[model samples]
Target: MARIEKFEDLKVWQLSREICRDIWHLFEMTPLGRDFELRNQMNRSSGSIMDNISEGFERNGTREFIQFLSISKGSCGELRSQLYRALDRKHISQEQFDMIVVKTDSESKLIGSFMSYLNSANYKGSKFTKPTSTSNHADAQNPEPETQNPEL
Candidate 1:
């Protein structure tokens, strides 16, 4: 596996971003954009998929990252549900609905696989790594005081 220094480097995040962009364009070009409430809600939910991934990766811990990935996956499902509404309301064509739904499904799978990999991997996360130190700061800055003799 390649080292992911940033969320953008992750395939799942990249794909999620693409899906979000597509949804944005669809809303802008289609009559769906006219529905203020649904348009805004769809935009927010689609954006959240990648946003959660980015947030989790920046958290610097495997556990937190996993939690964020789970949220992102849930967003994918939510977005799919909204797509159904769009289809039913004639905001989008059946073809468009199918394409976006497939993309969202793929994103959810990718995130799930990544989470599984993280769980079984030996490397916890960057935050869990202990920092190397040649000397103890407390010991170097302050010396221990001498104790009084009990016999005295």
Candidate 2:
């Protein structure tokens, strides 16, 4: 099994967390937190983006891991949507909206690229998976064969 020793090494995940931290601080300035509904929804969705990536990396199963990463991408989208809602309701300034939107979009693309990278490699995450699987053409209509458990 391959180990993901540093979360920072996962650039996409790290950036997502940074974006969330900035938003969390911004939220503190507003009475939005008192709203309960929007506040917790926004917070939890942003958090899920970071948490899912870490959980995916730790799982060390490329297929399932990529599934989780894809989920993270969706969560990033969800967070961005909520930010727009917050802005429309006057919870955030234009500058904050722009900052958060740009970063979130960047994170979204990075997640897509990461997914493409994995797809090109056939969902093989590490040296361990490489010997038994090749992800290169898996994204094509005719998918590559699934990786068997290397243990046997």
Q: For every model shown, what is its TM-score relative to the native structure?
A: 0.85, 0.77
lDDT of 2 by residue, 92-151 (tens): 888988998998899888888877766666545442343424465443423333323211
Worst 10 residues of 1 by lDDT: 143-152
Question: Candidate 2: TM-score?
Answer: 0.77
lDDT of 1 at 2: 47
Q: What are the candidates' C-alpha RMSDs?
A: 13.8, 9.2
Q: Which residue pairs in model 1 clash with each other? A: none
Best by lDDT: 1
Q: Which parts of model 1 have CA positions greater than 4 angstroms off? A: 134-152
Instruction: Highest TM-score: give the candidate number.
Output: 1
What is the Cα-based TM-score of model 1? 0.85
Backbone clashes, each candidate: 0, 3
**lDDT (0 to 1) per candidate:** 0.83, 0.75
